[model samples]
Target: MAFLPTTKEEMQEQGYEQVDFIYVLGDAYVDHPSFGCAIITRTLQAFGYSCAILAQPDWHKDEEFLQFGTPRLGFLVSAGNIDSMVNHYSVNKRRRDQDAYSDDGIMGKRPDRPTIVYTQILKRLFPDVPVLIGGIEASLRRLAHYDYWDDKVRRSILIDSQADLLMFGMGENTIVEVADALNSGLAVQDICYIRGTVWKSKTLDMIVDDYILLPSYEQVRTDKRAYAKSFMIQYENQDAINSKMLIEAYEGWYVICNQPPLPLTQEQMDFTYSLPYERTFHPKYHYVPAIEEVQFSITSNRGCFGACAFCAITSHQGRVISTRSVESVVAEAKTITQMKNFKGYIHDVGGPSANFSRPACDKQQTHGACAKRQCLWPTPCPNLKVDHSHYVDMLDQVRALPNVKKVFIRSGIRYDYLMYDKDETFFDRLVQHHISGQLKVAPEHVSAPVLDKMGKPRKELYLRFVDRYYEKNKQFGKKQFLVPYLMSSHPGCDLNSAIELACYLKKIHHTPKQVQDFYPTPGTLATCMYYTGLDPRNMKPVYVAKTYEEKLEQRALMQFSYPKNYEIVYRALKKAHREDLIGNGPKCLIPKNKPKQNASFKQERAHRQKRYSKT
Candidate 1:
């Protein structure tokens, strides 16, 4: 349960002459299980590997990476839990001022593209040392991917970073297997067949003929459509049971990605959670803002089945839900209550999608999720299982525990999936107990066309959920609200669709406090659509707002209530030929501005009224 050695001095104090693996990270050393570094390092320790953390090492200097001298096993690097480019910048490509993962919540501690930058540094320092890259940045960019920040199709991160190997997805099983292989004195290049990993080879003779061959890096670079096609092929083969080996040629080298490993079984889930975690940041720091939110929270599950187009969860965590037993979760809850500052509250107990406690259907376990179709999109599959009794029972057990005031499910709930269920027992209780005055749901947009492009359920389902939510709240005699998370300028969203969404917001008297412009990060269906202007699913043309001004206008339309957005909204309305929304009327989005002559007349009328009142 002690903190891992973060320094050479700490390593010496721990009675280790040589460390096994030195983990280089983009984030501050937070030992919480929510962090991939914490989980991977703890799992390695459980298997008797001496590991040390080299978190947020200064990238500009070579001395920072050599602190541990050199690890006996290898080097493990991650760009923290999130991609470094995403962590450092906003959707507008503007620099973000604060990093929640940093101590004191300051930015600039980690370099942009930390995985590539850190690995390149490691390769420079010790050329012979094995460097393995993983985490979101490495996982999503494992192949030739469109880089939004750079605005180019970059080669797979392994090609750029020159790291010997890359592991994708939740890498608990893979990392250990990698350590065992490397510890046995096998060459890094010789260990290429492990699941959930990407390895580079100088030639194609090592690749199996049956493995899927994506369009070469050269082809995908010049052809945006080819990139989309390649992304679809990657998407279809994410499942462990049915996935094929994939090989993509990058010039003279081949980047081979073996099939994803089987999802952790319930037993594995229990064991992973049971690993000793300090459940907070290393005590040397004063404050880690990320810990405050997750200190009392628990991740009851992993992965998500809601394959929304903009999400990377399907690619990172896969669509299959791997869950810990109710007993394991409750045991963690009991441990939380025993903490010194144990508040009466359990902040959250959920995963990628909170309510997805189990797989979508029974068949997914043996046959794998359907590659071509979604579980709860367009429409819920006929075989989709819709039960919440187990989740409700688990929540009941936690609620009944001593010293626990309230338990919340704050991650998110798929409202459409909730509505699809025939039973409503969980719904009534969710409103009564779980909601902290408001429940956050992501409707994304109100336009059916845009929703279709986003692979979300129709607007009709959201409307029904909205109506039923209020009714349920009324029954509970509690006043609560739904905070709808809205996005603008996604693929298939034009100025007219933006206006339609603005009108719907007005109808509901809702002005969103936060508006998210579509951020096309790597390895997403939406990102592919954004880059190609074509839906990879069917190669249908999609309307994409690519220009900065057009994207700003779409975002402004979502929050037209602010005076600053008035000009942009006005321009959008005018350009869309929806001038009807620009006039001074009840249904108008913005008032049409008049010329100086009208202003003078209004001033004269105001003066007359003032003079008459004085007389």
Candidate 2:
């Protein structure tokens, strides 16, 4: 019902001389469950701990972090909901102009690498206080991994940030357990046995559980093969039910990662969301751009089973599906209907994957996700459950609520998973009810070789889904269309593969308005491939589009219809020895001769060149 204290006066208003924890953030404060800071702080408050928010404090001034003085428990730090570097720079390494998490969509509100920066400031100001770091940035970088921004292998963030403890995964359970230990007078260094956490040690004598010793940092940093091998081991050990502790050696210390925290039960999931949240950004700011997309949206589930190679969700949230009850989801939707800004519309009602309302199979409950297999990748495993009845029922109850005119599912849906379901009831309802004129699904790429590296299904599967989608729309007399999300310049994507994608686009007579170049962020299988030119799953050489020109040409192939990209597409076709694609024929992606560039086209080209030239 009330926002957490953000200032000394508010701390006093809460009748606290000093708070237990100062939760530092790199984003503007928003008291919505969609934001991680809100959930963690509110969860702590629910456990009878007083916490304050220090949102986007000036890192240069030591006094800025000392606003609440030292806390009784310690400090909690997060680099917003995303990695600070990824939030600041695009895949091309060009600085972005707008930051959706900042006040009024402003840029440069927080320094780059805010976790390391903030931790260092806090450590310097209060040398004895403990600093616990988590979020997407720290969770993915908890081991020896490749950093695309640095273009080198970097040590674990716990080592780099010098934080006392690092909590990984969805840390609701992990945070509370850690808090209990600290409150019981345990030293940060000795609190190393908890699941879903990473800690440092001077020797391995303290490691009582069975653990796999990974290749040392020196080995992974110098040898790409060692890096790939190490990543595969870490990737396979993300399961809670069957994983062992992992240790990676450095010069004089070792970073130890415990097995992931177990997935929350349905009751626990509901209780976490049921906590009191103001559900908006702090009133001090006029507006926060990130809240607009999630204000009326509901998160019905957590974790993703679709272990895409380019995604880090599997590494962070784990592969087991954890969901809220249908009653909980309906309760939240009813709350949205009563808001002052309610427009009789609910924006989204899904999570990592919208339709994943239950575990992949009954076996996942007893045993964690298969270590050597993915639930829906290469092909849906024989044991895959492939049910959507619960999801359909949930949506039906939500839309039937009073004052709710429309409900849209904006989260990306795994089309391959949808196609696997034997029943067509969910598919038909999705097309007829949930779509907001256009539905977005990620096909990633069309080429078989590229799709293999991206961990996506074959193009035939997508084509089938597309055909069925159109059929459902026709049955309902609706004009909905599928907006397939495509990626370019991914690992294993050569010029020929790019040409193949262009030809496929020509066959469909569709062009994407915007295309995403594969971003090599930290701790993704795709990033390992981008850095080492080898797939971690199998130690096989893979084609990586690394050079600026090659990446540009690959991206141009996706938007071949643009006149400004005519030259780049032509060059790509010639480079691939596919000159047949250049002509007046219907299948040609470009013309034989260069097209005249208008002023706007020239300006856009010049701007792009200027932007990419920095990287």
Candidate 3:
């Protein structure tokens, strides 16, 4: 047989008139050649079950939908990528039992995309075809979930999405079995028998069979804000690890699907890394590239090593830097070069603090860098040695390819590790090839107490790097500058610290254009801080900008706090009879006249309730 037979040839061999099944899906990374979708889809193919990858579907446009496409035995509904994006997940932020403002977002808004809602339409159109759903989103939302902003418990999204069956957690293992059973002409409900899935009971009521819920993730409430906060905490802290599965006694006859399919073995990881992933992104959903600023996206690693107090990457992929070999990376780079717009560049070549590969440190201590949580969560067994030298060689090779322009490292790099350049370092070379005019780094905040609370270091370290950076920029006559990403009003950021940060930023001349106020996401250390006013990791009291007014002041400062912050500060000073240092001396970082509290959530809710009542 020919080494790589055409799709038609493979179809001929099957001797079947139709494909085994088709996949209507969603995942954080769509390039089927990279993530979990890659494994599941490829495995089905090996079993003679054909599959199509429909990344994030725009149900609004019937043309883009696949409800009427060729029928098959069944449809596998995977939500890890797409559902997670819609029902965004975060490792850290804040969580409240009640939500005062949660509602279906407006028309044309992203979170409200009609995929699941329209999946119901798919059911109407193809009434008999099975629509099985599974992935992180379905897994996490398998039961009645509390929406903090809405301040109400929302039903399982799996139920709402109208999937025939919902599976959860790392699904590489369960999906294969589901595919096999379907190919054998098994009933869709038969899939519920598999572990790691959620389906209806025989009683015709929702039966949420046990699905794996990482301890870190289970803590999150469904409010979108809480998810973001959770994400930030999970991304911080160099030595953070991952959380374990929880099997409870009180959920009622629930089977604890606590066993997440074991981490993808190296061979499986290699198979994914070697796929022709570059072309996997369906060009129809073109906005994906626009938002990412890259024609195509790729992944180098599946997980993160740094379990920051505010990040959730660990919660999703675990702390181990499960990676593909350099050879596999090279193969992917070759495919990316063949893109039609094939501008001589591979969009982004990294994931989760891209610079560090397979953490060199052990889980116990920090000789290198540890992404461990004090909670003894399963992080990369710290002693996992990272060989960045391979990356340097890979970047050099990628740039050397024909038509390959500057290979950009658009994925944010961990500034802390970049600063820890050993023996002249990989960062120096990384700067030349990957960084454009400026390397985008996330040194989230500058306040010491805030930094500690966020599992980050002080502002001095960021300054030290900046000083050295400017000196180099001047020496080389390179106008390339550094854009430092900052956040305000996180749990530890009080008005004073926010003001100090605003003033310090102005003094440095590198004022940020993008400023994020602390959004309390579910399952994050920072969110816990907002909820309890204490950093969970450090057990220290911290500032929580809980009230609307305080959140407003802190957020306003991040944007020049009214371009004339000094004026606001001056006014306050004058009112205190301390006018001596107004114009001639120290200026303030806050605005002179504070804006009136908008009370957006309260007003919006009242307005919505009134409108609903009118109806």
Candidate 4:
């Protein structure tokens, strides 16, 4: 269980003349199973492939990449846990001051586009060596899509980076298969049949028949409608069983993405987590801030059935929920209690959605998710099963373990799904034990049209959840608050819709402390809408707040209680022809300050003119 070799000295000590794979990461090396890099490198080690870490290498030159003297198999590149662009910049396109994934939480350790930069560096240094890219950055940008920072349609990362292959989703199965094939002396270009991966082919002869050909890169780049159309096709084919081989044409090459790898079963999920992870950052690094949040947490499940338009979980983790058994989760919890800095508290016991320990329904396992229909949207499907007793039992078991003080569920859950369940046992216990005063929930928006476009349930559903949450709090005699996470300037949200949301916030007597302006990152349905100005589902025209000022105005309206935000909220209301909202009435968002301010300004100007005339 020694750490992977990161330096030439370590490699020499380990007698590794040439490692099988050299993983170049954007973030500091944290050899925990929660990190994709750790799981991938550990899996390779399990398969007897020697892997070394070249984490956060300086991209200015290729000298830093030669530390391992070229990997025998290939070079694995990832932008750490988050996309590099997202890790480096905020939604406003401003450089972030801190990167939690870095040692000491410093910024600028990695370039803005780390995967492309590192891949280019490796390719230049070692012309014969193959480069493979995965992780969130490469996965979401595996195909040609919108770049929020560049504000243009960029080509696939595989083309830009010239990497041999792009492993898209969770790459446990794909990376192992890739390592084995490369070990067997298979050429990188010829290893095209692996699932959950994208590879470049020069000719159509390599492409299998009956594949759904997406709109060419040239087509999507030039035509907005084509981009939206292409997104819809890509969206529907995310299921493993029902997915077809997707082919997209470039100028002289074709990017062929194989069907996604099958989801891990319960046993497989347990085995994946059972790896001998140090469960901490590499000891060489003095401090890794990102580990503070998840070091004590456990990921009980993966994937999400609640497919929100703004989220990429459905694309990245798939729609089917794969969970570890209760025994495995409890064992992990016990191991956490024995950690050096154990505080007797487990931060989280969930994944994409905490409460989603099971599939949406029984048919999802065998039939695949309904192509056109959603499990939780419009309304919870009649076939949707909403059992939570298994999750409750698991939580109870972990809480009762020796040396365990309290188990908390900090990861977010689907409030609507909780409401759908006829059994309220988990809901009751959640309020009683799990929460820490204020529970953060994402309602996103309150306007029906905006909610519908965002793939969220209607306002009434959230309201009911709110009522019950507070009622449960009252019953427990614990004064807890519901901190609703709201978003502004999402696709399909105009000034009118923003005003509607502002009015709703007024009725609730709650001003959000934070309001996120929708950032159109790659591979989300909302991002497609943001770039195309049309809903991919029906190709309907959707209102998008494309201007920086308009986005600011919408965000200001969400937290209009701040004195600095009054002017923007007032202007937004005026522009939307809702001058009625500018008064002293209860329904008014802001007072008619200009009415008195203009008169004072005229009087002061008259006095100044009279004084100037006398002088």
Candidate 5:
């Protein structure tokens, strides 16, 4: 299989006068399954449709969009694998210096909100052509969402981009269905019946299925409570077996989102991964940093059942688990061994939650996930089946393959879920085989109030898991460590809560190198709480650290060991009446007195000040 045509010359070389769809992207094209565009385009090709690549075209040039001479069916636009705003800026709203998705880690290759920019330009260039948008940016923003960068509620991306149709979720099936409909000459406006799609409607007259009317755009934009209510409704209705059509009204029109498409079965998953991907970036680029991590990685599954409050997987991929057969995975591993740059290692063989290899329970397959309940949060549901035998067997087969050295499960392991399983066969094997020096796990916070707000397990559960993990390592006679991912400044986390987390870190004897402040991105329950100061699950007012200084203090408290953070941590501890943690005792996070500046450093500082004064 050759790379897809990216230029007019390549299209001619492929003996095409025109292509069926021009896939406009916001990132450098890397034909790997880790990329959403590659999967969608390859799936279309498998169903006998032609697609031309338009990877990271110049947004300022009208001629760039006209290179393909207009797509026959329509134009497919995606803001790459990541949200454009997130790709361009950090949580602090600072412009990022490097873009891994661009050539050679260069920044500013694509415009911010490329889906809106590209679609608007396409509409201007070819007024009658259809424009379809999907990927993380479009999927999460399919409905009215709170934009952290804008600090305001923005209308649905479907409405803002003026796209004829928006496909959400893992769009393998949705894209083909829409492509078939378009190939059959159905108009874009009339193609609203497909699942996993959001389209604008002037009226709800043609709607026959049962539907729920969400709070209108005006209501959600004006009232925070209304926004929270709307988000909760959307959250509950993500399952395919039971979800209903959702309609959000605007002043002159309505945005109708059909129920999500069913998750891929084992056979379908096998076929999707079996597509003839070139498995590397297009030769046009010198390097793409994003491909390094995923080049040797294999996505064994799709969707996540552990719906963390701060994650967008439930909103996009739903809670149902779809996995490839062990045979399929082994076949991919064998293919990797044959590559020219093949090493003896397979980077990863996991997905969203590594150990989640099947549905939460039998009822989830038939009746759909419970709307108001969680599978593993608070406590594991009684009906939740705890089995890692299949995952163990799969790993066993992969590692046994020829030319394979070690298969690591780099994608997180849900410790609470792992602890629930009485059978220790998988746990024993995991400690024996998968540890690449350190196993990374997310214990977002230790405070019960903060953990509840973050939808994470309590401190006791995490401590128990940690104890068991170390015991396993001791039994295996391996010197492995646990790298716990921590977050600070989440909703319900006050100054005292931050101090509690700092004390817990002191008890654990681990200092995290990086501490992520709670980022309020769209399509998350945590973000809703951050914006509304109320948990959508229960309309109770929650304490939120909104100011810059407070958030900085919370972050500093997590990494209180660093000398640079001593002042901030000291101020935070004092503010929380935690002067007890400021002494030179074993439990103290910082020393009583600040470190004195050396004579040479003081002289250098004074010299710089003097020079500035003279100037």
Candidate 6:
């Protein structure tokens, strides 16, 4: 019989449960391998225990019923799917009465910033219950981290959340061992010897399993400036894993291996994606006919090929994309379709880099995906290439099915790849069935130097892609338009690059009218650049964006299109003497309303100094 907790206090009093366990919190959306949630959720599932993923739980009210509903098993605490900055993002979305900033991503997510609040509440309600924390939010915040969004180096999230254990990296191997040991009546200290895990010993000392000593997940978070240097050094060929670092340790009866993760079978992959309540949380939707689940509840592909510097795809899932076959994906889709009170809308069918559908080319399959290297770092391995043709076809396959009308991309598709296509037919088809009128594409930047630093090609490619897109749209007389995603203050971005970006947006007769002040997610080459001003894996000079003055300039360039921003734009243009864009001379194209600096000058100055020195 599978393990089951006798009761809540048994869980709290037992120090840690054995094999019978419950993963308490994480992933408002179903986790995918391409995303960090994949490693944590799938690893536990791999060890032969039926798992329940509580995507989003109501914390304000008593949720003890949820704890009792599951078989008594150890509980896993995760927010990797939703980072702690859940509030930072949500607050940015809310246009404060007098505030100037906002957020992007057309899916319209104004998540309750109560991630930590909910986590803490769960702790209070389940006192003494074994809580294991792991995921980007928990992992990266496991140690003092430089928060670009906060402009401060903060302490470990474990210290903040009071979680018992915070496993880092891919949590499968470590989490399995953790559950087994606790279930076997082992102490937390016994599990510390395992690699890629962070746990407080019985004595309450933080013991990070550092066998191979990979950079802690905390080291991955950074502001914009450090990322510039990172961009210069990260490239494709540098792709390599230090096999010399491999080692194993104990987690109950099983061994935790730091070696490359074993490839998952298509059946296992299907089963993982095919999980039910684990994917959706809205029982209301269980009865109501809505467009989609109110919050996140998705089952998508495992990995993506696009290695955009700003993305964490390759690091989390390896550069080689691993996915269930399209038939498996369709089967999972059918499950959602068959759910009670099902709506015709299937939320999304994409992964880390949405349009990214294929896996490793050649080098990765032979050399092994570098857990440490980045495709956008020093350069892309000619081998670390992405072919979106398969994904485009996948989109077609999903949408053409019976009883499914729309499938949105909550994840952003790779615009650079789509724009690079030599044919117009794909564009036509995408507009027809897939886009349903408007779609969001991340071009990141338009300046050549900035794009180069960001590991993006140039503005020309995006423009070419845009032209082709519109050509098809005009031909079809369709209004399905591309909403360009623009990022400001990235590693290589500056006031000049922002201005250049503004110029390009004008050429295309478009205005994002929305700007993303780049949030440096953990585990990307860019985060290293944004941290140490060079890729920690390599050293190289790079441009940076961190100054308040420069940020305003970038915003002005974006605001040149919106007349409402004219006061700021006019003053900014006059100050910069770029009156060439003032009046009707020409339209400056860029997103409007960059976020306000939610900080004082001293803190901001400290950040600028720290960022500038690295650059």
Query: Number of the top candidate by TM-score?
Result: 2
Expressed as tens digits, the lDDT of each residue in 326-373 for candidate 5 is: 999989988888899988888998899999999999898889889988
- TM-score for all models, in order of appearance: 0.95, 0.98, 0.70, 0.95, 0.97, 0.69
For residues 123-240, write the lDDT of model 4, one tens digit per residue.
Answer: 8888899899999999898889999999999999999999999998888889999998999999998889899999998898856546999999999999999999999999999998
Give one clash count per candidate, in the order shown: 1, 0, 72, 0, 0, 34
Every model's Cα RMSD, please? 6.3, 1.4, 8.6, 5.9, 2.9, 9.3
Give one digit per residue, the lDDT tens place, for model 1 in 1-615.
Answer: 699999999999999989999999999999888889999999999999989999999988888888799889799999998888888888877777689999999899998998989999999999999999999999999999988998989999999999999999899999999999998999998998799999988887766636988999999999988988999999999998888988899878999999887899999998998888999899888788888878899898898889899999988889998988999889999989998988899999889988898899999999998999899888889999998887888888998899999999998998988998889988987998998999999999989999999889888889999999999999989899999999999999998899999999998999998898889999899999999989999998999999989999998998887666778888888898889888779898877873233566568779877865664
Give the better candidate number (4 or 5) by TM-score: 5
User: Of models 2 and 3, which has the larger TM-score?
Assistant: 2
Q: What does candidate 6's lDDT look like per residue over 317-368, in tens digits?
A: 4455555677877776676677666677766776666665655555655565
How many backbone collisions does model 5 have? 0
Each candidate's lDDT (Cα)? 0.90, 0.92, 0.54, 0.89, 0.91, 0.54
Writing each residue's lDDT as its tens digit, candidate 3 over 334-353 gives 77777677667677878876
Which one wins by TM-score: 2 or 4? Answer: 2
lDDT of 5 at 549: 97
Q: Which pairs of residues collide in candidate 1? A: 344-405
> In candidate 5, residue 610 scores what lDDT?
82
TM-score attained by model 1? 0.95
Error of 2 at 180 (Å): 0.7
Error of 3 at 608 (Å): 21
Q: In model 3, which regions exceed 4 Å deviation?
A: 1-19, 25-43, 52-73, 78-131, 139-149, 152-174, 181-245, 248-257, 277-292, 360-387, 471-477, 528-543, 561-587, 590-615
